[model samples]
Target: MSGGENSSRLIDVVLDESIGRSTPDVEHERAVAIFDLIEENAFHPVGDEGGGPYRLNLSLADSRLVLKVTREDGGDVVTHILSLTPFRRIVKDYFLICESYYQAIRSATPSQIEAIDMGRRGLHNEGSQTLMDRLSGKIEVDFDTARRLFTLVCVLHWRG
Candidate 1:
């Protein structure tokens, strides 16, 4: 990719293990989201002219989501702490729908699985939008990047 492309993307993402551990399924989701995020994303901290492919460390503290951004060389950029209140409902619903979808994969018909999957994706999208809105003026990210970040957020929230 070009220099500009590299400057606005994430090169690495780390989830704070102290927050919690994930189940196998959740682990898979976290891994995939991180992979996808690093592969391509638009992440530019507002007013940051560091021109860097950033590193992100996600963690939860006191029911709040903490986003720590740093330059590729580990220089501090910015950290955003956001309330989890707005995402509680959507994350809960998304978890329910995801469970249904996973269960459906074992026995339900393709149509049924597709329907559940649709709801799961819808919730995911809603959560992504909420994240983008919450990060407004703090961090700028495209919709797809927001989606992946939302997935990571959900992973951090997962207790099992």
Candidate 2:
């Protein structure tokens, strides 16, 4: 791929297995988010000289979020370490809403299910915006990309 085409997107994404295994629901969400993110996203590491089509590895260490980026050929690019403190409450609340949404899908009326989903989506968007704000000068990503990344971040926070 040409540098321009490759420079602004991620070709691969991985979550650290050390974090903990996820439930089936979380696994499904992780798969879909990675697929959607790779299919289309705007991810450009600011001040990167190698250009992109980057490979991103998401992990948590020392209670912080680590975003390790690399070139398509596995060359080193940049690693961003962000605090998890800002995400704790959002992630907690998001999981709660997600649980409600999942439960609603099984027994609640369509309207109830929709209402719960709306709340879940709102939280997701909020998380996305927070991520974007945090990455302001490090990694530039569009809102859609941020949303998918937020899902992956939640996957990292998944304890079960």
Candidate 3:
């Protein structure tokens, strides 16, 4: 497929309710990430499926990240389950940096805040790259899509 072929992308995304409770901030973050993801993303599932506007459900079950992908009308496409072990360290670091970034916003100088935010973005990129690596052959997603999906994964890790 060519670059301008209207690559498959998500039409709707749902996170399982069993993922556990979330604070308002976490919820807001999730909302923004999902909104951004669906607004503009590149998600092309492997195999011939005539391209798609897919629906994805993300959840955690038995310590594994469960990704359930389907067509817009609910036809099953693929289910990808990935272990959480690989993401543990990066997610932990991401959360810690996020906390610091939030704090830095309160009293730190502009430069300090910018530096912390840069570190946060760096870690975020690392996490997203890890996700893309893990998702290889399962589904294809662009960097920005991976980044947004990484945020959702980190949100799930919050309860793990």
CA lDDT of every candidate: 0.88, 0.89, 0.86
Name the runs in model 3 displaced over 4 angstroms: 1-4
Count the clashes in each prediction.
Answer: 0, 0, 0
List the pairs of residues colliding in candidate 1: none
Looking at candidate 3, what is the lDDT of residue 119? Answer: 96
Tens digit per residue, CA lDDT, model 1, 9-82:
88999988756666897788788878988988999999998778899998878888888999889999999999
lDDT of 2 by residue, 106-133 (tens): 8999999989999999999999999999
Badly placed stretches (over 4 Å) of model 1 are none
Task: Find the 10 residues in a row with the least total lDDT in model 3.
Answer: 1-10
Worst 10 residues of 1 by lDDT: 17-26
Q: Best by TM-score, which number?
A: 1
lDDT of 1 at 158: 71
